[model samples]
Target chain A: MTDATATRPSIAGEQRIDGSDLLGDVEFLVARVRAIGSGHAREALAPFGLRVRAYAVLSLACGSVSPTQRDIADFLQLDPSQVVAVIDSLEASGFVRRAQHPRDRRVNIVEATEQGLATYAEAREAVSRARDRSLGSLSAEERETLTSLLLKVAF
Target chain B: MTDATATRPSIAGEQRIDGSDLLGDVEFLVARVRAIGSGHAREALAPFGLRVRAYAVLSLACGSVSPTQRDIADFLQLDPSQVVAVIDSLEASGFVRRAQHPRDRRVNIVEATEQGLATYAEAREAVSRARDRSLGSLSAEERETLTSLLLKVAF
Candidate 1:
C-alpha cells in the first residue's frame, strides 16, 4: 500500500523488502560467492576424497602453523566439533598424526603425515584451479585487488 | 624434506604445504568472511527466530519479484531441496504463502504475508547492524570499493 511504502525504504520499483537490497548487499554477495566457490572446491577435491573444509585443515597441518585443533577452529571460524570431525577423518585415513603439544600437552598438535603431505600437494593444485575459476571474470589486477581488500577486511 | 621442497612450491621456510597461501587466497578469504558474517547475521536474527538463510528467503518473498522456489534457489545458488525446506518452514510460520504461479501453475510463487513483511523490517535492521559490524576496519570508501569489485566479479 502507499502508506507502507511511505513508511519504509523502497527500491527499484518493487519486490524490495525493508530497504535491504540483496543483490547490492555486499554481505549477501559474499555469502553466495562462498557457496559457489566452496561447491567448486569440493567438487575439484572429490577425487581425493577430501571436502573443501578437510582440505583446508590438511593445508594448515601441512604448514608450519603447527596448530592445535582449537587454533584451527578459531582461525577458520569453525565450531570445535566440526574441526574435530575433520581431524578424526584425516587421522583415520592416516593422512595426519596428532600429538600432544610439547609446550602444552593438554592440547593436541595436528601434523601431516608423509602421505598426507603428498595428497595435499596434488590437492593444492586442484584447489588453486578452483580459485582461478571462482575469481571468474576478474582480471589479474582485480584478483589481486579483491584478495588484498578481502584480506584486510576479513582477516 | 629437501627432496620434497625441491620438487614442489614452497612458502615461508617451514611446514609450508605446496605454494598456496591460505591468507592470500581470495577464495578462502571470501569463504571466511561469509562464515563470519553469516554467524553474526544468524545471531542478530535469532531473536526473530530466523536464520540468515531463512531471512534471506523471506526477504525475497516480501518483495515484488514474486519468485518461485526454483528461482529463489537459483538466485541464492542453493540446492532446490534447501530452498524447498525454507519455503515450507516460512509457510508454516504464517510468514509466507505459496501459490501457483499465475502464468505457470505447475510452479509455486512465494509471497509474504503482512506479518512477514513486518518481521522482515525488524530482522532487516538487525542484519544491517551485523553488516556494519562485519565490515569493521574498512572505511566507507573501502566498503564501496569492496562491494563494487565483488559485484563485478560475482554478479
Candidate 2:
C-alpha cells in the first residue's frame, strides 16, 4: 500500500493507486467524487433518519413536478423497485404521499407532505454545509465552473 | 410526473423537476454522472465476467504499487469485508494472488497474475469505449478540464 505520507499527490478519501491509472480516467474520477460526497451526505442526513438515496427521493418529492415512481427511477438511474421501496418508507415516515395524477388516473404522483418539506429544508442546509466542507478546495468561481462542466457531462 | 416531451430543458437520463433545485447541487451532479458511467461500465465488463468493483480491484492489482486489501478498500471507499470478498472471487478466477508482504508479515499484497493482466488489457479497452460514449458530450479538452476539476474535489 502507498504510504499516506508519501511524496505523491493523493486522492481525498482513498490513497492514490498509481498503477490504476484511474487517476486519468473520467469515469473513475466521477465515481470517486460521488463516493466522497455520499459519505458526507450520509452523515448529514443521519439524524433525519435518511440515506442519500432516500434524500434524493425526498428532494424530488418536494419538487413541483410531483414526479411518479417511474420518473424518480429514470432520473436517479435507480431500479423502479428501489424507487417504490424508498417511496414506501418515505410515505410511512409521513414525508410524502401518493395522489391520483390529474391527467392519468393510472399514475400516482409522488408529493412531499408538509412535514417532508420541513425536514428537507433542514437537511438541505446540513447537506450544503457538508458539501462545502468537502469541496472546500474549490473557489466559488471554480465550483461554478465545475458545476457548469459537470452539468454538461452529467446531463 | 413531467412529460418526457415537456418544454423544459431536461437532464440526460432523469427529467428535470425545477423545484428539486438539486439541478444546482454539485454532489447530485456527481452522483448522476457516476451512476450513468457505472451502467455503461457494467455493460462493457460483462463479457469479461467482471463487475465494475471487481474491475477496479483488478486495475489496482495490475498497478505497480502492489496494493494490500486495506489499500483497495480505502481507495474505493468500500468496506474492508467487501474488498476481501471481491479479492476472494478474483483469486478464484486466477486473476490475482495474495502474496506475503515484503515489509509486513501480517499484510498480504495483492498482485495481478499473468492471466489477470491479459483479461484487464482487453477489459480496459472496453471500459474506455464505454466511458467515451457516456462523456461524448464533452470535447477532449473539456474532459481534461473536467478531470482536473474532479481531481481537486476528489483529493
Candidate 3:
C-alpha cells in the first residue's frame, strides 16, 4: 500500500506531530490540510445528501432574511451562475424556494425551507464534529491561534 | 449596477482581509479558497502556456527522482485520475515526459524537461507573489500557525 492509504487510519489520530517545521511553504501546507478536512466533511455530509457547497448556501440562507441568489453567492464566494445552479438543485429538492424580489422583478429572493433549516442544523453538527476530529491534535491555544491566522490570511 | 456588481469589489477585498476568521468551517473554507486561488493562478499561467496544476506537476517531477504520477497525486492531495489529466496536459505541452517504469510495468514515471523547469521557476515566483498579496494582512506568526493548522487539517 502507498503512504496515502497506509496513513488513512491515522488521519485524525491523537498525535502531536509537527510537519510544519520541515516544510518551508505555509500556503501549500494550508492547502493540503484544508483538502483533508474537506474530504472528511464531505464524507460526513454525504449521508445527509448535502455537498459541501450546498450546505454553505443553505447555512447562509438560514441566517439571511429574504436574500437574493446573488447575496448567497457573494457570501459564499461563488459565481453568480454557480449560485443559480445550487439554487436550482436545492429548489428541485424542495430544500429552498425562490420568490420574486419585492422591489425588483429582475432579482429572485432565496429562502431556505423549514426542512432546509433542520437539515442545516444537522449538517452543521456533523461538520463541527468533523472539524473537532481534524483539529484533535492541536492544543486549545493552537486552535485559537490557527483560527486567528486563517482569518488573517483570508480577510 | 445590480447588487451583484456593487458587492463584487468589497466581497473580493473582504475575502482577502478576513480569510482566517471566516475559516470557521475548515473544509469549506479550504475548498473555496483553493478553488479561488487556483482559478487565479490558472488565469495567470494561461498566457505562459501552463495551467496551475501542470506547473505543480512539473515542479514535482523536476525536484524528485523517479516519481510516479501516483506519487505526485499523493503528495498534492489530488485524485490519481486528476493527476493523470494534469500530467496529460504537461506531456502534451512538451514540458514533461512519461516513460515506462523500468522496474514496475504497472507504473509510469514522470520527468520534467529543461523547458519545464525554466517555466516552473518563473511560475513559482509568480505564484509566490500572488500568495503574498493574498495573505498580506497575516503576520509571520499567523502564517506559521495557518500553515500548521492547514497541514493538520489535510492529514
Candidate 4:
C-alpha cells in the first residue's frame, strides 16, 4: 500500500504543491526562529555565567555615560523590578557597579566594570557568530529585507 | 548658554540607520522584539497578575493535548527552572493542575483548570487587541510584509 502520509495528490492540471505553503505562516515561523535563537544564547552564555539580559545590560552600560537604572530599563524595555535582579546579579559578580547619582539621590547610576566590559565584548561576538550561523541559510539580500521589515513593524 | 544636550543628535536617526544596516541580523532583532513584546504584555497582564511567561504557560496548557512541563518549556524556549516557577505559580493560583502521566511516570502532565482557561480566553483577546493597537501605525500590506519577512528569517 502507498504511504498515505507521504503522498498527497496535486490538483488536476495544476502545478504540484509542496508542503511549503502549509508550513509557512510568518508568525509561527518567526516564533520558532526566536525560540531557537533564545535556546542557543542561553546555552552559549551559561558557561560565562551570564544571562542574556545581564549581557544586554552590560552592553548598554559599556559606554562612558553612567546610565541610570531607569535609562537602562527603558532602553531594554524591562520592568524596574526586573532590572534590579539583573543588576544585582551583575553587581554580585563584580561585573557592574552602582553609584549614587550626584543630583538625584533616588537614581542609581550604573556602569560596567572592566571585567564586565571584557565579558560583554566576548559575549557580543559569540552572540553575533551564533546569529550568523542561524541566518546562514538566507541570502544577504533576504536578510536585509527581513531586518527592514522588522524595523518597519517595530517603529 | 546653549543646551549641551540640544546639539546631541537624537538616536532615532541612529536607530533607522542601524535598522537599514542590520536588516539581516534576525537573532539581534528577535531579542529586541521579545524585549519590547514582553514589556508590553507585562503592562497589559498586570491587572490579571500574570507575567507574559505565566500567561503563555497557561494558554499552552489550556490548548495543548497532553502538555508536559518539557513541552511548555520547549514551546516557549524558557529554561526548565523558569518553567517550574511559572507552573508553580499557576498551580498555586488554582489555574492549573499537575498530574502524573499515565504512560510516563517521570513526566507531569499539566492542564489548565476551568478558571485558568477562562482567564486565558479573556487575556488572549485583550492581548491580540493590544498587539493590533501596537501595530496600528503600519499599513495592512506592511504588516503582511513584516510577518512574511519575519517568517522567512525564522523558518
Best by lDDT: 2
lDDT (Cα, tens digit) per residue for candidate 2, span A16-121? 4674678888888889998888899999999999999889899998886778777788788889999989999999999999987655666667889999999999
Ranking by lDDT: 2, 1, 3, 4
Candidate 2: what is its chain A TM-score? 0.86
Q: Give the TM-score (vs. native) of candidate 2.
A: 0.87
TM-scores for candidates 1 onward, in order:
0.83, 0.87, 0.79, 0.60
Q: For candidate 1, give the lDDT of residue B130.
A: 90
Residue B5, model 2, lDDT: 54
What is the alpha-carbon interface RMSD for each candidate?
6.4, 5.5, 7.9, 8.8
lDDT, model 3, position B2:
34
lDDT scores in order: 0.80, 0.85, 0.68, 0.67
Binned by DockQ into CAPRI classes (incorrect, acceptable, medium, high), candidate 4 is incorrect
The docking quality of candidate 2, as DockQ, is 0.46
- Runs off by more than 4 Å, candidate 1: A1-20, B1-20
Candidate 2 runs further than 4 Å off: A1-19, B1-16
DockQ of 4: 0.16
Rank candidates, TM-score, best first. 2, 1, 3, 4
The fnat scores of all predictions, in order, read 0.46, 0.65, 0.28, 0.23
Displacement of the residue B81 alpha carbon in candidate 3, Å: 3.4
DockQ values of all predictions: 0.27, 0.46, 0.28, 0.16
Overall local distance difference test of candidate 2: 0.85
Q: Model 4 fnat?
A: 0.23
* Model 4 lDDT per residue over A75-130, tens place: 66678999999999999998899987665577677878899889877887777777
